[model samples]
Target chain A: MTRAALLLLADGRFPAGGHAHSGGAEAAVRAGLITDAASLEEFCRGRLHTSGLVAASLAAAAALGVDPGDLDAAADARTPSPALRAAARRLGRQLLRAARATWPCAGLDLLARRFPKGAHQPVVLGAVAQAAGLEPLDAAYCAAYESVGGPATATVRLLGLDPFDATGVLARLAPATDRVADRAVRAAREALDTGVDALPAASAPLLEISAEVHAARTGRLFAT
Target chain B: MHLHHPHDGHGHGAPAPSGAAARRPDGTRRALRLGLGGPVGSGKTATVAALCRELRSELSLAVVTNDIYTREDAEFLLREAVLPPERITAVETGACPHTAIRDDISANLEAVEDLEDAVGPLDLVLLESGGDNLTATFSRGLVDAQIFVIDVAGGDDIPRKGGPGVTTADLLVVNKTDLAPYVGSDLDRMAADAKAQRGHLPVVFQSLREEAGVDRVAAWVRERLAAWRA
Candidate 1:
């Protein structure tokens, strides 16, 4: 049941406007920072390690009943780039809206109200997932799926890769997703035990730079 | 460590204000959310500038701009002094402008909410989609009404191209009509094509360089706002 919920949340067709974004893949691709599938895989792996880690940690905290506002602030601090901070908040707000419509909960609604301006996407997702009774591990999976799967799916459209090949790539990355989820679950347990305030900061400067460049270009396929 | 204490106390003592509760009791002075979307350099920023100039006196306005990489559009509006800097919110879409406005709409919605929070009871919120392709259209879920902007410079036959945006926007604005003579675009043909494409929806031929082109668009928005209230 949790797996199904994670799939639903992570699905590219969930209409959260994720299709228009490549999560900095477009800029990296254009700058030759990422070339071919190998580089793309490496990029995804790195993202999984950095931004993905932050998202998963936040999601896990939310699953553990952490306040969404606190999670949002943590996300904001973790993201050093103004551009990325904006994007994360944007995605978070949208995801929260959809989550509210699909699964209403007091905790989620309260979180939505806390960041009237905007909240980070992962934080919101975590809060909503917790409200919906998803386990921390499941929440972590959903976060990783979105952070990684979104870019991978976008790659298909941007690179014009065969759908079969894309599916193959996703299949190969399935184990990595599991590994990442395990780490996130462990991290969340540690955070919950030590208090979410004790979590360490993780920021990727290169990704931040790439996102800023992606934002400036007049011609581009994705939003961020 | 000390910074965390106050926040924790606040979180525990009181529930954060909900979005629904943030609304003014009267709610009569709600803002109309307008979405602008089209290809890059299609003069979306120019149109926004023109609208702010035309409508600022009559309406309480705010703007939410989705730029792919920078706050350039918001900065442009700021430089033009269209509205107070606080009234304008920028969402660095980071990837595709369309996603922020259409697919996800969270960032844009939050920006709208933020503007409302900062400047209560705005008459309208203009959301400028980052320059995008012909396929881009604002989600009805995001904006009360949307304008699909295409310049005559893009091509006269663009209306005939039959993209979702051209056919379905609340208002189809054929901007840069002044450039028509230079670009070899026949205004009449483009108008007719747009009309054919949109059976009943209104289409306006505008040259922002003209004295009152934006006013007409603003008037159309006013009508929509009136209808929304009614």
Candidate 2:
């Protein structure tokens, strides 16, 4: 697997429709759950263990050549909020466009044809990773890091928080991110034998509930 | 498998792999896309509304609005009844309108494509950018042509400053000309500075409050459309 491909996929400027989303951070900020770098760190940590781990495991599984159709269903089963599901598919559809343009592969084309509206983003990310000749660990790392990165960047914009403070928060979370990716890939590998049921189902109830509220908001900075 | 296929040139004569110039699977050309970008309250929405009123009788048209936060721009167009509600789509820019129109255009592209799919055979699609700074401009990949609107009330110095939007736009519009005298702006200086900054590019001085609102801009659109079809 090429390391540069991983960098390209992980770049924040990949142009996959991620800028409009805050990954539930906008809702958290509006609710005063994240006010400064320290609270932002706490929010990201909670997310890394729950949503981040789940997304990473799914992406790793997809990268390992697990059927994206089945994994998409598993993702749906795990996410309870309809708003979150829509956002995931919306972003997934955008990623599919960028990935198709960047790395044309028959599998990616087939998936695009099957889910024109989109599958979950992690499912598409994993497929994109496979198409880019990246390892399952690369996909896992991409998903895990993005899970926190989106919120960190959004916080800097929303609160006028110091950009360095946000970067520092991400730097501090690097070790945890690595551990999560390791766990995610292990779970993905196990799923190859025991089926996708072996993947993590860690849930963050507040994130899901807040996502619904954020969706219902008439005027919001982020699309959730 | 071949990993890297060369992307087709978009918005020019070459067939696009996707976005504005991308043909349907049936190999038919999509609509011409024009972008309107400028500073806040530069009469962009008013121009779009006037253009819709002026041209809707002869051609199929749709609009995609990039708003920083609220759907105010789209709402205003809707309230004006310029076109049916279905023809207007709004894209949230995450407080970065320039990024949505230029750096990463996925959302705006999606909005445009969906508009065509839903209300199709369109002759034109106007993308109205959210109010932003003078540096903001549309990506060539996103629009066939772009118009930068700067009202006389904003300041005649805007043309002298000559940022990317003012200098490089396909057409520069000095709007709210009727308010020029009230605001103490010299139209000739604004015009000369615009000429100096833009060289051969066209600039239109317009006032939507006038009887011939949007005629000059509509004529420009017609010329572009004719050239595109040719």
Candidate 2 on A1-224: residue-level lDDT in tens? 68899999999999888999998899999999999999999999999999999999999999998888889999999999999999899899889878877897677878877887789999999999999999999999999999999999999999999999999999999999999999999999998888999999999999999999998887788899
Interface RMSD of each: 5.7, 4.9
For model 2, what is the error of residue B59's alpha carbon versus the real structure, in angstroms, after optimal superposition? Answer: 1.0
Worst 10 residues of 1 chain A by lDDT: A109-118
TM-score of each: 0.78, 0.96
Residue pairs of candidate 2 with colliding backbone atoms = none
Q: What TM-score would chain B of candidate 1 score versus the native chain B?
A: 0.87
Candidate 2, residue B108: CA error in Å? 1.0
lDDT of 2 by residue, B73-159 (tens): 999999999999999999988878999999888888878878877899789999999999999999887888899999999988999
Clashes of 2: 0
All candidates: DockQ:
0.24, 0.50
Which residue runs does candidate 1 get wrong by more than 4 Å? A1-3, A13-33, A50-54, A66-91, A114-120, A150-170, A190-194, A197-224, B1-29
